[model samples]
Target: MSIAKRLASQTAIYGVSSIVGRVLNTLLVPLYTSRFVAAEYGIVTGLFAYVSFLNVLFTYGMETTYFRFANRPGTDRPELYNRVMTLLLLTSALFTAGLALLARPLMSLLALPPGHERYAVWIAFILGLDAVAAIPFARLRLENKARRFAVIRFANILMNVGLNLFFIVFCPDILSGKYLAGLRPLVEQLYDPSIGVGYVFLSNLAASAFTLVLLAPELLAVRFRLNLEPLRPLLRYAYPIMLMGLAGMVNETLDRILLPRWLPEGFYPGRSNLAAVGIYGACYKISILMNLVIQAFRYAAEPFFFAQSNEKNSPHTFALVLKWFTLCCAMLFVGVSINVELVARVFLQRPEYLEGLSVVPVLLLAQLFLGVYWNLSVWFKLTDKAYYGAYIGVAGAVLTIVLNFLLIPIIGYMGSALATLACYFMMAAICWWLGDRHFPVPYPVARLLIWLLVAVGVVAVSWWAPIGEGWGRYGFHALLTLGFVGLVAAVEGRRLKAL
Candidate 1:
């Protein structure tokens, strides 16, 4: 199959799971937003922001490390897999055990209500489970088991959604003296009506474990025997990546982490930061279209790029891949920008949460820069100059810290969005500029810029043209999308056809 077609197939399968999962999860945004006040959702948001950072800790950059060494010539695939799996198991166990030990103190530090300590424990467990499962998922990607990958991914999301509905939607009525008035005594004995957002975390913990059950084949494939001798080089390779991952995550999530500290009076007093976080997060989900695409491309491209290391004109091939990724991502940016009002409403069921709408475009562009940074980063990885990646990340992290510290206090959530955008753009530009000197790839920079300009023009026009009310906005967006499609065809139609 042609590369674009292969990528398209993988993207479709990946998108089926990712896009659908994001949509299903997005459904819960409205449920949570409508049911819980902004403060409650903010706490949910804040904790999960921490969860995103913790995931990087639990995985410890092994995902990319495994891909790097696994694709290196003359490496024994099974041995490499075993080594990485064993390492991950150790870390996962250690992390869970530590969390189990320190859950109370950490909960206190997060300023959880006294009765809400269990929420921290449940989140810790969910993350640990996900960490343990990371290797198996990465293995699926490396082996090109896209179908199995999609199935497991989609199934996990469905399980989470089902559990969430049972806990948040069905359980309250089922347990209360309303629907089951006859069994009120029995139901009251089993269900605690005041659990509130804590149940969300518990439901997630249960669903995470359930997701692991479906990975029985991968779990059973784990061998007792693990080689430590082959791990030295992998560790050397992964150390900088871990730093990069950690710093990168801090850049993305630290604003959420430190926002409470920066605010003299919290965004909403007497409420958990999770609620404000929820508003930010729910709106943030609207931008996941680009993130999901970037994630899918990374799944396919990383291993593929490493394997093609010795191929003729390999750098050129990488450049081409980067070009296409940029093109498609630019298209997504325009698509989302035009339809954002429709998309924003999906998660903002409460009119109050709609206050965060202005930050949506800012966050979307930030995520777009993040995807571009990811594509630009392949240069450092292929050349084994990963320390450069670390430098770039630290630069971004410094920006993240300085901006969030300064502006989040002044402008609130909008500051976080702006910080993220600035960080990612700086990282992408530095990586691209520095990478060209070491391992030059003739990316069609001019063509790529043209596409971006066209996307900007489309968004500008869409912003100004009302096209009237109700469904008219969607009609306007449709016309805007067609205009983009035609422009891409006119400018690069033959290039796409050649693929």
Candidate 2:
């Protein structure tokens, strides 16, 4: 099979797990919004936002480091893998113990409500488990274990979803009932009717614990060792990537943390701060379709790019890949923008949440730019100038912090969305400019710009078109999607066929 075909197949398998898992996860939004108050869900949002940053800290860029070192011709791949796994195990253990010790003060610092410290502890555990699991997951990718990777990932997600439903849906009924009469008093003492939002974190903690059990195979396959000789070079390579990952997470999540602080005092009354955050988070989930695609592409693209480094036609391949990425992301922007009104309903159970609908396009396009920036970043990665990624990511983070500070005070959450879009655009433009100087590729710039313009035009038209609510809106979007796909096919059909 051609590289493109192989990539296509790998991406499809990865996408099935990622996109399908996310879609199933999306259903939790309605379940959450229905049962929990918006502010309560805001806690869920804030806590997870914190988890996102911690996840980056814990993984510390080892995935990319593994990819870089594991591909070296003289390397002992198994030894390298075991060394990294050992490092992760030690770090994860320390992290868990430290967090457990400091959970109360940490909770207080994050401004959790009274008696919510346990939630923070649970979240810390979740992140620690995920950190420990990172090496095993990366090993799956390293070994081209895409099928096993997908299955394990799918099973983990299913476990999360099932446990979530039990905690949020089934457990409530069981608790409310006078079951066996002996259990009623115990249940009443343990279960709080007002703890509606706490279940989100609790369920996640449970699922994380369950996932550790499933990773037993990946853990037992490799001997544990940490060799410092290889670690020196790996650390040098990984440190910049670590900075890049940390900055990247900040770019993605800092808004949720900052918005509550910067919003006008009493913006929405007592719970509205959290409610607004919850609404924003729900709308963001609708855009995960674009995120999943970009992610799947990266999973295939990185290893493929590294393996082809010495090929004479590698630059050409990278250039072609860049064009396809831009085209697909642009098409996704148009498709999601057109159909978002319908998509919003899937996540928001109440009309009040629909207030966040406008933020969806901004968030979606921000993610698209993010994907483009990532695709264009291969130059630095392959050449081991990963520091440049750090530079670009830091620049983006500064932009994010400044813009969010300025705008959140004025426009509330929408300002955060706009700030994110601007930040990602800046990063993409900067990365492309820098990458050309180091590793030039003859990207199809003119064609890519044409497609972007077409997307803009399509979005404008779709907005003005009087598509009624419900099925009519979806139908209109479906038609627009078809039109965009047709244009792409017509323009790129021959190129694809030749490949």
Candidate 3:
């Protein structure tokens, strides 16, 4: 098969796990919003924002470093894997222990309530377990164990979903004497009705622990070895990626983190800070479709990019990938933006959470830019100009912080969404300019802009001129979606056939 065909095949396999897993996880949003009030759900959202940041620190860029080194000529794959795994295990253990010890102080720093320190503890363990599991997961990708990887990932999603149902759905009924009268006392002892959002974290902790157990085969396959020869080169290469990862997290998640604390006092008089956070967080889930596609592409693209770096037509392949990726993301942008109201009504249980629905289109567009940035990022990674990636990320992070501070108090969560869009647009644009200077790929910039304009026009038309309500409006939107798809097919059909 051709390289493009192979990449498409791998992406399809990976997408089965990523798309299915995320869609299932996204279903939990209604479960969460329905069971917990806005303030309570806010805690779940805010804490996981911190988890995104901590996870970067815990893994310390070792996964990408492993891919870089393991694919190089004359490298010892087993030894390299063992060394990286050992380092991750030691660091993760120490980090978890330290977080557990300081859980109380950290909770205080986060301004969490007095009784919620255990949330910190559970999150610490979750990040730690996931961090340690990173290398083994990357090992599966590097070795092309896609089916096993999908099965393991799907299992974790299933376990998490099951545990969530038990804790959030069934336990309350048991406590309320709906059934299992004999088990009420034991269930009551374990499940606290008052600990609303804590159950979400607890379920995640259980899932992460279960996943670690499932990964024991890969974990045990490598002999325990901690050599220093590879350590120096690995760290030297990975530190910048680590910094870039941290900055990227800030760009991606800082809005959720800051919105709760930074929303102007008395903006909503008598409202808890978390109420705004909860609404924003719930609305953000509207963009999960775009996020799922971006994530799956990243998983497949990273390894593919590295493996193809030395090929004669690698740049051309990368260019083709970027074009198709842009088209796919633009389709999602238009689809979600046009149909967001329907999605919000169906996916989110509480009417109060729907107040922030206006932010959905902006956030989806931001994510599209982010996906493009990730594609542009390949130039830097493949060219060994990783520090450029760090620079671009830091620039975006700074933009995110400054804009969030400036705009959140004035315009509420809409400010956060706009800030995200600006930051990502700048990052993608800058990366493109820099990539041209260093390792140029003939990305179809004008063609992509035209596609984007067409997408925006469709969304605008749907917004301004609705045909009818309910099924009528949906039918019109479906026609528009198909129109965009047909446009793409006509434009790319010849090239795809050639491939």
The prediction achieving the highest TM-score against the true structure is 3
TM-score of each: 0.92, 0.93, 0.96
Off by over 4 Å in 1: 176-190, 266-275, 464-478
Tens-place lDDT per residue, model 1, 338-428, is 8888876776778767767777767777888788888788888888888888888989999999998898778877888899989998898
Leading candidate by lDDT: 3
Candidate 3 lands at a TM-score of: 0.96
Tens-place lDDT per residue, model 3, 1-499, is: 8788888888888887798887898899989889888888888888888888999999888899999999999998988988999888889999999988888887776577798888899999999999978999999999888888888888899999999999999999898889898999889788888777788889999999999999999888867778778599999889989999999999989998889779987676656778888889999888878999999888888999999999999888889999989988998898788888788877789888988888998899999999999999998888777999899999999999999999999999999999999999999999999999999899998889888888988888988894878889898988888888898889888987887
Candidate 3 — what's its lDDT? 0.89
Query: After best superposition, candidate 1 residue 466: deviation in angstroms?
Result: 8.0
RMSD of 2: 2.5
Error of 1 at 105 (Å): 3.3
Candidate 2: regions farther than 4 A off: 176-195, 268-271, 464-478
RMSD for all candidates, in order, please: 2.6, 2.5, 1.6
* Residue lDDT tens for model 2, 110-136: 567678877877877888888888778
Q: Rank order by lDDT, top first? A: 3, 2, 1
Clashes of each: 11, 0, 0
